[model samples]
Target: MAYTAEAPAIAAGDDPMVPRIGRVRRRVRELSDVWTLTVEMEDGRPLAFAPGQFNMLTAFGVGEAAISISGDRDRADSGLIHTIRAVGPVSGALTRLGPGDVIGVRGPFGVGWPVDAAKGSDVVIVAGGLGLAPLRPLIYAVLASRKDYGRFALLFGARTPADILFRREIEQWRRRLDVEIQVTVDTSGEDWYGNVGVVTALVPQASFDPQNTIAYVCGPEVMMRFGAAALRDAGVPDTAMYLSMERNMKCGVGLCGHCQLGTAFVCRDGPVFRNDVLRPLMAVKEL
Candidate 1:
């Protein structure tokens, strides 16, 4: 008998169900409310991910959470940087871990923002609250290769002045002549002076080819739903509009069933989906 290499499976198989465990290199606090964690394969391999993909972040004994990749893939030292909000036990625990802490990583999972589909097309990104976390990579991707995209617009909203993430970066983006940055907050203080409304309010102010524009939206479910409607009203096609979804997930792989939505799994099928594809699902709850 001769030894032979196993042929790679063509069909989806058990391997897709297995999780890839990566080690944490460092955890840098990005803001008072969020932390950026960088993790890589113990074997020191680059994590190949497209803009908008998320990974399952696991802390030993605590549990797993789905986090979006926030680093530029073109950067060599870039690993996975999940900008996490401390909202629960798992996330709270994650905030405490520092350099040399170990965490489990299962994927460069989920469908990503359609950078390729939007090539040469006008891009509009609308994000609210921590929703900006997933959209960061797409922003970086477009700016890094600015010539590849056309008229760019970013409309972001937060609950309050304090809730805004990526403040410094947003300031830098505001200075660029090629891109537009519009920010709004749900509420405002005396010192705060900017657009004060839901993110939907900013859509009407944008000037772009609805027929040629692709919109990426992420936020609270209610906000996303409303944002999609606003885009349609602005004449952006449903097919060209996309949204990043978030749900409770156990296995970053599809085996756990925690993140299942209808026939799709948010972990595997998508964190990013066309607005038209999700419209039907948005009507149903926990399907």
Candidate 2:
């Protein structure tokens, strides 16, 4: 299949650093602390995004936060979805917004997942906690083009059963015979019947040819490092493993240097990077 990159839509006279007004179409509370907001440009233009790009959302008086675009890439009319956890002031303001509320949006920035390159290869997706939000679009792209890939396995972990994001969608994916889904939690409750352990423990259970598999991992920095090691043990080479790196991003562009890791800028060079390129830098504590 031919892959064509989608050019980001910009309104006339719009500045890349300036935020455009967007209206909240709907808001769904996914978990106790997490909320998903569906927002559309006030002008009604479709917000096009690749599988792993993000947007800097601003609440009028509040500050801004870099949030991954979590909606289906193919459905432009459904608006952009951002699953946010109210952990701080800016995020708290975003979560407090309801349908019809207006907010500022300034992106579709950062390099996205290499879903196209993974075609014909077995794919392993590993996500922990809120990291799953960024990987959600990649999963949609993969499943939407299911025939183009080999086996698909998803291993996800969260704090507990209640902390799991997209519970309904996860259940639906689990019901699909073509997809393999395993979930784990750091701690389990009496209501939880699934595995009780770190997400890496479920990595060995995924059935994929290590040589033919491409892995995408996103989570806490420590969790990502461990997940990459586990994938390595499973036979996946560093070249075949990718990770999403999170950092303090003051500017969506590389000019600010806030999101820099060594010589690379997370906002411009990547939010997604192959393990081989990032492994060395990740080992450095100061960076």
Per-candidate TM-score against the hidden true structure = 0.90, 0.95
Each candidate: RMSD: 5.8, 2.7
Q: How far is candidate 1 from the true structure (C-alpha RMSD, Å)?
A: 5.8
Q: Candidate 1 lDDT, tens digit per residue, 1-287?
A: 10111111212432444555666788877767699888776757666677788776778899877788888767626677889889899988877778777787766677788777778999999898989988998898899889988899999999888888889999999999999999999999998989898999999998788999989999899999899999999999998998888878876667778887766777666778787777776666775
| Candidate 2 vs. true structure, TM-score | 0.95
Q: Taking the tens digit of each residue's C-alpha lDDT, what string does model 2 give over 1-287?
A: 11224335444577879998999999999999899999989988788888888989999998998999998999977898999999999999999999999999998788888888889999999999999999999999999999999999999999999899998999999999999999999999999999999999999999999999999999999899999999999999999988988988888877898987877888777788888888766666655
In every candidate, how many clashes are there? 0, 0
Q: In model 2, where do residues sit more than 4 Å from their true spots?
A: 1-13, 283-287
Q: In model 2, where is the ten-residue run with the lowest total lDDT?
A: 1-10
Which stretches of model 1 miss by more than 4 angstroms? 1-23, 284-287
